[model samples]
Target: MDMVQSNQLEIRHISPEVRKLIKMYADVNNCTQSEMLERMILEWDSQQSQSERPPGDEDE
Candidate 1:
């Protein structure tokens, strides 16, 4: 897990579509906006990590 200490997520830079999706998902999950975004970012990171691994190189 990452050790990010910052509490700021500048929403102004996010595309309108993504911003709306975030809001909708956050409301559905009953969590704070930042919390939802953090989960999303973490999920993306995990997916990327898995895809970037070389075949047959699953050592952790």
Candidate 2:
């Protein structure tokens, strides 16, 4: 795999409780910690993008 195709993502400043939650969810979901974080970030981005669109902006 090319390095450019898979970039690193550094997440900082999270509380210990959040860190433990991530680990627990990752284990329950059968994915790595990084994968769980990616899922969370992507879901948040999708929701924000939908909310930011103008009224009646439904996709065809």
Candidate 3:
């Protein structure tokens, strides 16, 4: 996948627990925080689209 040029996203309201989880996940996966976030967002988007599909439309 190609990287898109975009403005930075500054999240200022995350909880400490969530921050720790993100850091831990990034460490375990050996990826930077930004990479982890992008991967997670893409996976979530894919899951959302799949859930929105009709019962018999999965084979398309």
For candidate 3, lDDT tens digit of each residue in 1-60? 233112015323556787678778989999866666667778899999989989987677
Model 1: how far residue 37 lies from native, Å: 0.6
Global lDDT of each candidate: 0.77, 0.73, 0.67
lDDT of 1 by residue, 11-44 (tens): 6578899888988999999986677888888999
* Residue 12 local lDDT, model 3: 32
What's model 2's TM-score?
A: 0.74
Question: Each model's RMSD to truth, in Å?
Answer: 3.3, 3.7, 3.3
Instruction: List the lowest-lDDT window of 10 residues for candidate 3.
Output: 3-12
Per-candidate TM-score against the hidden true structure: 0.76, 0.74, 0.74
> What lDDT does model 3 reach?
0.67
